[model samples]
Target: MIDYRRIGALLAGRREGYCLPQGLYNDVDVFDFDMDAIYGTGWLMAGFTCELPTPGSYVSQMFGKWPVLIVRDKQGVIRAFHNSCRHRGSMICKPGSGSAPRIMCPYHSWTYEHDGKLLAAPRMGDDFDKSAHGLRPLRIEFAAGAMFISFAENPPPFADFAEKLEIYLGPQRMDRAKLAFESTISEYANWKLVMENGRECYHCATGHPELARTFPVTMSKHFDRANDARAKEFVDTMTANHLETEAIEGDWWQLARFGLNRGAETLSMDGHHMVRKLMCEENQGYVGSMRLAIDPHCFLHATSDHVFMFSAVPVSPTETLVTGKWYVHADAVEGEDYTVEGLSELWTRTNLQDKELAENNQLGVNSPGYLPGPYSRDAEMLALRFTDWYCNTARAYLAGRTAMDAPIHVD
Candidate 1:
C-alpha cells in the first residue's frame, strides 16, 4: 500500500528554489502521489476548441488514469465526460478522434448523446432510472480557444488566469485557427523531467541547432525586472500593445506583448513568416512571437502566422507522452498558404532534442549515485519556479487546502 503520510512528509521537506530530490522522480509511490496532487486537481489542456468544429465531433484521451472524452454537441458547445459507459463501464469512445452521431458503448450498446445524457440502454426494466445514468461530467474552461479540463469536484477559478492569457493570445486569434498538424512522442523520462527541460532553453544552444536558428541564446535566461532595462522595455511594449488591442477589440486584459531577441519574426527555418496570411490587423508587420507557459501541462507559442501548443501527459513513473499541435488560419490552404514542413520545423526538432535530454537526465537521476543539484539563478529560473510551484501545490493539497491558494509563480 502507498503511504500518503510519508509522501506528505517528503513534499514538506523539499528544498525551495532547487531541483527536487531524486526519489520524487523515480519512486513509484511518489509518481502515484504526483498523479493525484498535480494532474488530479489542476486545470489541464485538453486540446484546441477548433479541433471540434462540427457538431458531434469528438476527441478522446486518458487524463491521468481517467478516460476522458471531449465532444462538440449539436448545440455547438464543447463538453467533456468520463469516457466510460454508465451501464456496463465499457469505454464509450475509443482513443483518438472522430465524428459520431452519439457515443455507443461497444460492449452493451448503451448509448449517450454528445453532451453525455443517457439516451438508451436496451432491455433495462421500466423501473430503471435513465436520467441517473449519464456519463460523469468534468469541469472545463477555455482560454484563447484552448480547452482546459479539471477532474476536481471543486476546481480553481479560471477567470483570473484566462483574463491574463487573453491579453497574450488575443491578437493571434486562436479561436479562428484550424489544426494544421499534430504529433505525439513518448519520452523515457518522468513527466516532471519533461516539464523541467521545457521550462528553460539553456540546452537549446547545444542541443537544438535548428530551433536556435531563430531563438536567441542570450534571451533564454531569466530577466531581472528591477534591474534589467531590457526587461522593463519588454513590459512597456506589452502594455502598449494591450492598450492598442483594447482600443480596437473593445476589451482589455493585463500585459499583452513582449520582444523577441532575434530579428526572426516567427518560428521557422529562415527566421520569417511561414504562412502567407497574418492574424490581427496590428500584426501587419512582424510583432515577434508571444509565448505562454501554463504550469504542469501546457506551453504555447503564437506568432502572427500560427500557434504551436504542447501538452505533457504522464504515462508512468518512467514515461511521458508529449503532444504537439500546430494551428494556422482556418482559411489557409495547404498548397498556397503554408506548408506543414515549414510550420512544424522548429518545434518538431526542438521536441525531439528535448526528449533525448530529459531521458538522459532521468537516467542519471534514477541512479543511486545521483543527488539534487542547485539550480542556476539566471538560465534555469523558470525551471526553479516550476519546481517551487509543484512543491507548494502538492504541499497545499496534502494539507487539505484549496489548490488555487498556493502562491502564483509566474515568469
Candidate 2:
C-alpha cells in the first residue's frame, strides 16, 4: 500500500525547504510534458455541454498532444474521436467548429458516421472490413454542464472532478450559466507563468490598472498599490468600500466557489475613476471575479451579473493560445445591442500587463542566481496551495504513482 501519510509529510517538508531558481522559467523540458503527462491519462475540459446543441454538431481541435473531434450523436450522446481518418492518414474534420451529419476526410473523402463508424471508403475494395477502419474513440464524460475528454480508459468519472470542485464553489452558481463572449491569445511565456500570476492578488495594484479599479483588489489601503497609477482614479469612487466576504485567513477575499489560475498583475495604485455601478445586496454585491484554475487550461470565473471564463491551450514552452467564454443570463446576452468589448477589455489589460511581466520574468529566471521568493502566509496562502500541488503532483507522477495523494495542509 502507498503510505499517503508519509508522502504528505514528505511533501510538507519539501514545500518549506524548497527554493525554485529563476531558471525554471526557461526550462522547456519541464514545460513540454511527456506523452503520458497529457495523453496517457486524466480529464481535460474539451468544451461546454451547451456548445453542441444538436446531433451531428461537431468541433475539432488539437487537445494536448492529441488531435481530437467531438460530436453529439442522434442518440443525444456527446462523443469524442481521435479525428484522424483511418486510411491514407488524413484529418477528418476541417473546421474548428461546425455541424455535420458525419465526418468526411478532406484528403481521401472517407466518411464516418456521427457514432464514428466508418460509413464508406470509395476506392477501397469490398474485401476491406469497415469495422476495422472506424474512427478511434476517446473517453468522454460530462458534469456541471461542462464536457471533458480523456485518453485514459479507466480515468476517474467526470462527476468526481465536479464533486471535488463543488466543495470550493457553492452549488447555486455552478449549475446555472449562459454563453456571453470569448477570445484567444498566443503568448511568449510558459503556461505556468500565466497561471501562477492569476492565482494571487498581491500584484494587483502594480500589474493591472483597470482590473485593480473594477475589482476588489486590496483588502487594505495606504499599502502602495500594485499599479499605483491605475487604481488612483477609482480609489475614492468605489462608493461602497469593498464588502469582503467572511475572512478566510485574514485575507479580504470572498471565496466564490471558483477562480482562475492563469497569472495576472494588479493595476495597483488607483488612477482615473471610470463609471462606477452599484450592485449592492445589502451593500455586499458582486464586486468582480472569483477565478480558479482547475489543473490544465480550464479557468472558472464568476462576477456579479455574469461569469468570464478562460482556457490556456498550451502550444509550446513559450507560447500558449488562450480562449475566453463569457456567460450571462441567456436573455441578457442578446435581444439588445450588446458588446463583449467592456468585458474583453478588462482581460486585455490584465493579459498585456502579465505579458510584460512574465516575458521579463522568463528572462530573469534564466539568471542562474535568480530565485522565487516565499509567499506571505496570510496574503499568499492560496498561491502556496498551488506550489504544494505542483511540487507533490509532479513528484508523484514522475515516481510512477497511478493516483495523486490528497493534499495535506501545512502548519
Candidate 3:
C-alpha cells in the first residue's frame, strides 16, 4: 500500500508562491497520487455534447488508465461507462470512436444496449442473471455544451459549477455547436509541467510569435502594478472591453472574458476572425476571448467565430497526452463557412510551441541540482492558484475527506 502519511508530509512542505519541489514533479509515487486525488476525483471535461449528436453514437479513449466510453443512449441522454466487459474482463469497444446500435464484446460476443445494459449472452448458465451484470456506470455531469465525468464515489458538486458556467457560456450556445477539427499531441513531460506551462504566458513573447500577435503578454498577471504607459494602456483597454461585454451580456464578468493585445480580435495569425460566421448569439463587435477554467485539467477559449477546448490526459510519470478540439456552428459548411486549416492553424502552432516548452521544463526539473524557484510577483497567479489547489486537495484526500466536503479556497 502507498504511504499516506509520507505523501501528506510531502504535500504539507510545499511552499506558497513558488514552484513545486523537484520530487513532487519527478517521483512516481506523487504522480500516482495525483492521478487518484485530482484527475480521478475532480469533475474533468471529457468531451463536448455535440460529439454524440445522435443516439448510439459513442467515443472511446483512455482518460488516465481507465478506458472510458461516452455514448448517447436511446433516451437521448449521454452516459459514461467503463469499456471493459463484465464476463471475461475484455475491452468491449475498440480504441477509437464510431456509431453502433449496440456495444458488442469481441471476445465472447456479449451484446449490450447503448445504455450499458446486457442485452444478450450467447450461452451462459441456465440461471445467469443479466440484470446483475450490466456495465458499471460512472458519474457524468453536463453544462453549456460540455460533458464532465468523475471516477470517485462522491464527486464535487457539479450542479454548482454548471450554474456558474451557464452565465459564461450560455450566450455561445456550445451545445448547438459541432466539432470541426481535433488534434492530439504526445509530450515527453510530467502532467503538472504541462498544466504549469498552460497557466502562464511569461514565455509567449519569445516562444510564441503567432499567439503573441493576438494574446497579451501580461494577461496572467491580473492584479499586478502596471510598469509603463503601454502597460497601463493595455489594462485600461481590457477594463473597458470587459465592462462593455458585461453590459451587453447582462451578467457580471466574473472570470469569463479577457482582453487581447496588439489590437487583435481573435486567435488568428493576423489577429482576426478565421471564419465569417459567428458562433455566439450576440452580434456585437469582438469584445474579447471568453476564458473559463474548470480546475486541474481543463481550460477553454471562445471567440466570436469559434471555440477551443484543451485537456491533458496523464499517460505516465514522464509523459502526457494533450488534446485540443475546435468547434463551430453546426450548419457551418466547410470551405464556404470556414476552412479546417484556417481554424486549426493558429492553435496547432501554439500547441507545438507549448509542447517543446513542457519537454524542456521536465528535463530541468529532473536534474539533481534542481530546486523550487520563486514565482514572479507580477505574473503567474494562475500557476500559483493551481499549485495551491493541488496541495490542498491532496491533503483533503489524505484525511479521508471528499473534495466537495473540503474547505474552499480561491483567489
Question: How well does each candidate superpose onto the true structure, as a TM-score?
Answer: 0.90, 0.72, 0.89
Model 1, 1-411: lDDT tens digits are 556666666666577766888878988998787888788877888878989989999999886567899999999999989888888688877778889998889988988988888899899988889999998998989987878898888776778878766666767787788889999999999999999998787777899887778766546444333455755665565555552211111111122234555477777778888888776445353565566676688777777788888889888898999999998989989879989988898888889999999999999998889878888887887788788878877776766732434432221
Q: In model 1, where is the ten-residue run with the lowest total lDDT?
A: 245-254
Count of clashes, each model = 0, 49, 0
**Candidate 3 residue lDDT tens string, 1-411:** 555555766776677888888877877887788888888777778878898989899988778777888999888989999889988879888766788999999998999999889989889977899988899998988887788888888887666667767766776777778899988899899888998888788788898998888887765464333455654564466455432222111111124465566567677889877877788535353556777766677777888788988888888888899899899888888999889999999889999999999999999999989888987765776677777777777777777733534432221
At residue 101, candidate 1 shows an lDDT of: 94
Better of 1 and 2 by TM-score: 1
Off by over 4 Å in 2: 1-24, 38-40, 156-158, 164-178, 219-255, 258-290, 333-337, 401-411
Which sections of candidate 1 miss by over 4 Å?
A: 220-256, 401-411
Q: What lDDT, from 0 to 1, does candidate 1 have?
A: 0.77
Q: How high is the lDDT of residue 402 in model 1?
A: 29
List lDDT for all candidates, in order: 0.77, 0.56, 0.77
- Residue-level lDDT of model 2, residues 89-207, one tens digit each, is 77777637879877889887889989989998897997989999899999887655667787777764455546544433332243445455666666677666666666667787777
Q: Model 3: which residue pairs collide? A: none
* Candidate 3: regions farther than 4 A off: 220-254, 281-285, 401-411
RMSD of 2: 8.5
* RMSD (Å) of each candidate, 1 decimal: 5.0, 8.5, 4.7
